[model samples]
Target: MNHLKIRSQFKYVQHKIEAIDKESFRYNYNVIEGDALMNTLEKISYETKFVAGSDGGSICKSSSKYHAIGDIEIKEEDIKVGKEKALGLFKAVEGYLLANPDAYN
Candidate 1:
């Protein structure tokens, strides 16, 4: 597993891979600075699983879990925003994979 650190204008995030295989990937991330940290977000974890589809494609199932700092509660709207961002990233990856079929293999 590898650890990554990302820095941007709005946030500094740390990511640690929990597990990975041909069919699934799992990781946890922490917002260590900026907006999310100021807003009480502790960490976010994600698991993505891929399965073969009927028409020679793949079906992706992804889940995200958010943790708040201390006793603070995260808002539903905020979670929704996170979900949207994740979906966008997924689509971008899918597009790249589709464009270069042998890239991953």
Candidate 2:
């Protein structure tokens, strides 16, 4: 199944969005497309232009839409805690890699 990419960039974006008023949140997403099942990733050799189109942008949001994305719906406390866990994990992993450069191989 397709899962949202876990990256520090996404974490930063989440933190920034959280720091702002949550009530103001409307459009939220980074996924252009994803498969709901396994082995469904768009083939590496294929291109979206062949089927999708020139516009890589998402659909325009309606002002009436008030629903939030699933990832964003996590409890505020959990979001904060999750980021803290992520920060610690990142530091630990990177620190290990830096101390063992050959481990990258």
Which numbered prediction scores highest in lDDT against the true structure? 1
Model 1: per-residue Cα lDDT over 4-75, one tens digit each: 233334545556676677534333334334564456776677777778789997788878777777999888
Supply candidate 2's per-residue lDDT for 85. Answer: 59
Give all candidates' CA lDDT scores.
0.67, 0.35
Clashes of 1: 0
Model 2 ranges off by over 4 Å:
1-73
Q: Tens-digit lDDT track for model 2 on 1-105?
A: 222234442322211121222354343323223231112322111111112235973232221111234434434564356446545755676567667767676
Compute the lDDT of residue 23 as modeled in candidate 1.
37
- With a 3 Å backbone cut-off (N, CA, C), the pairs that clash in candidate 1 are none
Q: List TM-scores for all candidates, in order.
A: 0.71, 0.32
Question: Against the hidden true structure, what lDDT does model 2 obtain?
Answer: 0.35
Model 1 regions lying over 4 Å from their true place: 1-11, 23-39
Per-candidate clashes come to: 0, 0
